[model samples]
Target: MGLFSILNYLRLKVIVTFIRLIAKWQRRRLRAAQPGPNKKQISIPSRDPGRFIEGYLYTPPETPGSPANKKKPILVNWHGSGFVVPSLGLHDVYCARVARDSGINVLDVDYRKGPEAPFPAAVHDTEDVLKWVAGQGDQFDISRVVVSGFSAGGNLALVAASVLRSSFEELKLQIPMAIAIYPVVDITVEPAQKVVPKPIRPIPAFLARIFNDSYTPNPESRKDPRVSPALADPSSFPGTVVIVTCEGDTLAPESNALAERLKDGKRKVVHKFLEDVGHGFDDFCREGSKAWEQREAAYGLIVHTINEEFGHSG
Candidate 1:
């Protein structure tokens, strides 16, 4: 064969190898889900259907390295399930770490998942949680408030932040800063080739459609600014730390692109890219594991950014 023919064959083999690697990573995640004593199965109190959100609160036994006890920063977290799966009752380790290591009080918001409670519901659920935490945490020293979530949940956090900022400007109260980890910024697919590329595209897109359909009723919700945050005119977003971690060249390019846009609009923003990590990695395991290491790195960057933006003592 000519030299060019051999080069083409080698390139194809490399692409195939990358696909096999992503498949292995997906399998490892599926296996990891079944083993644990951890899921911190705590009950959310006073289950009022209207006011009751289905998640737990984690307060550190000791607020390590805290500057003062004026008010513990409230970190309201939204769980991501492609906006379909229930908050799995599986992310307790993550809740605990956010509270303990970050020295911030954490509230895992169990926003109603899709189908029965579609687009505006998850967005509303998060907004309600913020109001509740602010009102209720008067006792816990909640002088400062912030919101964070993963994937779809991160999208909720941003939408909620946008809405909350509008509320605060109208009400004259403090608008909370936000941390969005691997957030689903733009649901409109960004020209396909911009992110997914020609290879390994099918299932992720298939899974995404399946996921979106389950939670959204009106197909128009897909274009609603509240439903797809990246579609919004981000003139009034809160101080945000946009975190991105990708594996096999996965999600960060979109995240990087979003960060670029946010910066262009002059929003208070920060962005970080960790090496060789994939989506939903934080909820996978604890320390000494590769996933745990990735989660911690992402988590630490968020903490520093929060502290820097809001300051340690709120």
Candidate 2:
């Protein structure tokens, strides 16, 4: 590692250690305050044994319909933590709620994060999970798979879809749709510049730089299509893309830009702009609040898209 790389690594180590400590406390409180639904904790073998990936498969409660007749669709979700924290304790309630509301299998991924396994590691882990899901078609019904993510995870979702699209013919994998919630699609642009209509809580440039450095380390890596999906060809994306942007979020501009590019490329794209809310309003805001309402609306859009793709009428 070079001097800058070593410095970045050390900085990430310290920050991640502090964040993990806080995350531990947050997880305990969240678990107590908002208990998640029953989910099977399963591990997916990865090429890197040291950085094995796990996921929580949240299957909705059985309905009157028989399993043989109704094989539920799967939603593979990647949780957001700026590519540092694990998803194991962060998105429990959100993932369970998605499965419960949509009646689909929710696989909440716990992929390798930065400062330990950076850049292509998380992307590779996501691809591996998708391949594993494909192999479990009997269980997950991979014929209808939707990948969704929030913030940094959203970046991973788009990149993973692009990677899968490149190999879809050989892999026989088709990502019917994808949802990116306040995604960091362009690392090249300054976060402050990306803000539009001004944010209630603008992301600090220092923090954004930290996230970028920790995840990508090498500046040149930031230009990679996997790191910055905005740099990729619009046609490389999967069908029916949903880009959710919060008006008060510093990242909204890039998200909107990506959506516009998709539209320009004649790809089906839905752009949702939530006014007066900051980044992660969907995950952190209280229910019945305006932010929460918009968040719910976004989820409704996701469910609607899935239903439409499956040829199910409202």
Candidate 3:
């Protein structure tokens, strides 16, 4: 057995303990809080090239003072679940809030989860959405497109930006900007191995192992770019906004490192950080935690970050 395997075996007890700790500390999330109302779902064309593509389009609230259709920005959002889980109901509030605050059209892409679909499926779904959005210029009057995601979705957003670079060039498509919220980039580096080191957050090792077992037991597939965007060349990054919560995040350092990498590459980057919030703090807001207000604020930061990336105040 490998050293990691041995470490994992010894750490199994600790892993169980942490899971219980997280479960006990976290209130059972009954339902996600709904944001203010906005545009309802409208059908739109998907890209010609992709496997199992799906999306729900949302528009801004129709008000007497709403922005003109041709002038509103468009946000293409990807949901987070580490490419495995698709429990996006809770995450939808963020997008809805963005639409309300920014008055931008939101395209919530329902990308496939992995294990059955695995690495390439998630990123491929994102790229396909990119194409689909580009094709929707006449429909949504989408002059400015900003890509956004949180955690795993954030990583995919960055990867999509990279993959679309060539596609943008070929199709004469505008190079859309990206907003990555606590993104898990560098798939090549195991988060369990580094961020949540074995003894510290033992559950990550267990979960990652399970993820590996489910997605691709074969070690080779885990190395694929679709599996690990961190393996992608940072020197060639697209325009980005890296939102990180410092001091209490597993992904903060890596995200900060990525921002430096983007700056080094001479690409535009907005690096924002919240000092005291933990990882996924926004989504973790329970019924009556002090963090409820903080969590509520996260959506605003997300919208502002995306609009800022596109140089639009709205």
Candidate 4:
């Protein structure tokens, strides 16, 4: 490995080791506080040898005499950890709530994170999970499938949708929509754009660089569409795309650019900008706060899109 790769490896080791110390306690507290999904754990074989992908599937309670009871729409969620940390357990509350409120099947994937697995691993694993879900016609209705993520997960979601569009032509699968909440769509932020005036900057320039370096060690690879979906062809995106950005977030500009690109491609794009909030407001803010309220609204839009696609009256 080269010098940058060596540095990235060292950084990954240090960060992951620190996280492992507190992860167990954190997971215990999260599990105790949040009610879990209907199915907690399901392992599926990955293309990578000796590595099995684990996911949590949440099936909403069935309503009597409801057509949706026979076939429920699928929502695949990817939790954000900035590519270095694996925090799938922390997202349990959000996933469970979405499943309960939307009355749809939610599958929260614990895909391999970076510094260990790196770029293509997470993207490939996401595609594998979608393929596995598609094969389960009896269990899930892939007709109205929605792929969503936050932060690094958001980047992965876009990559997954693009991959599914290009590679799975025989599957004839089209993700109706994709929801990316405050996503890091662009890894290559110009130096001038990095120094945003204070009060609106949520992610510091140095920290963003660290994330990009750790996840994508090679500077050239950072521009790859799989690593940065903002650079991808807009036509590769799903028909309907929902991008949620916070006004105070440094990443908002790229998210806006992505929405503009999608619009230019003639795709249906819902661009939501939450004023005064920072990055990770949706996942970190206390319930009933303005941030939480905005987050709920974003979720409502996602559910509304799903219902409209599936023609669900309820």
Candidate 5:
């Protein structure tokens, strides 16, 4: 490897180590406050033999008098990590809340990330996870499955919806809808070039560059639909999509553009621009703070959208 590549690799290692430590501490703190949710760690065998995708599954409390044999709808959630941070349980609390509020199973899944597996690896992992979910018809209502994600996970949500469009049909499965919050839709633009009006908590250019380089090393691949779903054909996406973008986020403009393109009259595309917040503003918020309130509102919208799509009253 070139000297620069070697240097970035080392830098990435250091950054990842620090972030992982912080995430570990945060998880412990969150757990101490209260039992966040009733969730269990589960692993699904990947397409590659011996490989596995790890995730936490949150099953909501059963409703009184509900049929014991009834299967519930499932929401497969992917946590945001800029395709670099491999903090699997980062979304534990978020996933728990969604499962309880939406009254469905929420799978906060983990995928292989960059500087290790790189592009197409995470995408393929996502596809494999869906396949596993499709096979669990006895436990979940596969026909009502929904995919949601934050940041890089948000990008995967749409990319999966577009790239796996036909395979899902062949499997006789219905994705029903997808939710992307503050997603990275276009990587063609450099991190420093992205525009944010408020710039409250924009992603640092150095970190973004590190993430981009580690995730998609080939400059040309940045235009590929898998890396930049904004360039993909809108019709390839699922029929219904709910896109949430923070007004102060650098990713908002591109995400908003994709939302607009997906609106073809027949498709149900809801783009909600949360005023004044930056990317991931809902994350790590103190209770009773403004950020916490925004977090509640965003999560509430997610529940409402899922229930509405599944024909359930919320």
Candidate 6:
């Protein structure tokens, strides 16, 4: 490796290690505090030999009217890790809550991350997971598949709904809706330039650089529709697009722009901006706090949007 790449790799290893440790602690605390529902650990086959996509599948409680053999729609979720840290189970609360409230099966998929897997690896993982989901017709209603994510995962959600939409046809899969919360849609812009109105907590410039470089490496690749997503063709998105942004977040503007682009009068695009909050505002926080309230509201909106799109209370 070259001098610059070597240095970048070394720094990223440190950052990723430290962040993942913290994430592990936080995940444990979250599980202890609010274990929403029981989930089954699953391993889905990946195109890569011996490499499997790991995930947790949360199935809603059986309803009286629902048939025992009936299949439920599935929501595939990817967690935000800046495309670097493998912050698995970080969205357990959100996934479990959605399954409980919406009565849909929720799959929290863990994909390969950057500095090792890089750019298209996660993207490919997204498509492959969807294919696996579609194949499980006996277990899930593939026709009603929906994709959702937070931050970096949100960008993946959009890409899965767009660039990978064609791949779904043969598998008989369809993503009717995609809920992206505080997504990073434009990586071409400098991290410092992204900060506006002063977020409650700003993403560190150095960390942002590491995330960007580790994931895409080539600055030129940052503009690829599959990478930035904001540069993608809006028609490529799902039938219903739900974008949630935090007013204090640097990513809000790009997310809003994406919502606007998806709204061609005919297509259904919903943009809900949460005021006085910042990125990752939906994460676990102290009860009764402002952030907590916002988190609840955002989760409610997500459940509501999914139900509405699926054409049922679930």
| Candidates' C-alpha lDDT | 0.63, 0.77, 0.62, 0.75, 0.83, 0.86
Q: What are the per-residue Cα lDDT tens digits for candidate 2 across 1-314?
A: 78977876887889878877887777666452344556888988887666568887888766554454567788888988888876564566667766766678888887778878788888888888888887886676666778888999899889877755566545555787888888989998765566566767777787777777778877899888989998988778887898888888888888887888889756678888888788877655666899778877877776676667664311
Q: Tens digit of lDDT per residue, candidate 3, span 1-314?
A: 69975565445435434544664445354456665555355433444433445566667776565445455678777776655665444466777777766767787777765455555666666776777776766756444677778877887777776644566655445645777777876655565655622122222555756544444445687676565565667655665555554446666777777777667656667777665566666765665674566666666666676656554434
lDDT of 6: 0.86
**Model 3 spans > 4 angstroms off:** 1-29, 42-52, 62-71, 141-143, 196-203, 287-290, 309-314
Q: Pick the lDDT winner.
A: 6
Clashes of each: 4, 0, 2, 0, 0, 0
Residue 117 alpha-carbon offset, candidate 1, angstroms:
1.9
RMSD of each candidate? Answer: 10.7, 2.4, 5.9, 2.8, 2.4, 1.8
Which 10-residue window in model 5 sums to the lowest lDDT? 28-37
lDDT, residue 261, candidate 2 = 80
Best by TM-score: 6
TM-scores of all predicted structures? 0.74, 0.90, 0.77, 0.88, 0.91, 0.94
71-128 in candidate 1: lDDT tens per residue?
A: 6666778876677665544456666665655666677777876554567777776666
Model 1, TM vs. native: 0.74
Q: Residue 180 CA error for candidate 4 (Å)?
A: 0.7
Clashes of 3: 2
Ranking by TM-score: 6, 5, 2, 4, 3, 1
Name the lDDT value of residue 269 in candidate 6: 86
In model 6, which range of ten residues has the least summed lDDT? 29-38
lDDT of 4 by residue, 1-314 (tens): 88976886887678666765675666565452365537668887888777788888887766677775477778898988778677775566667766776778888898877667777778888888888887877877777678888888888888877645566545655587888888878787652374333345466666566566667767888788888888888878888888988777777888888888889756778888778777776655567888778877877776776676655533
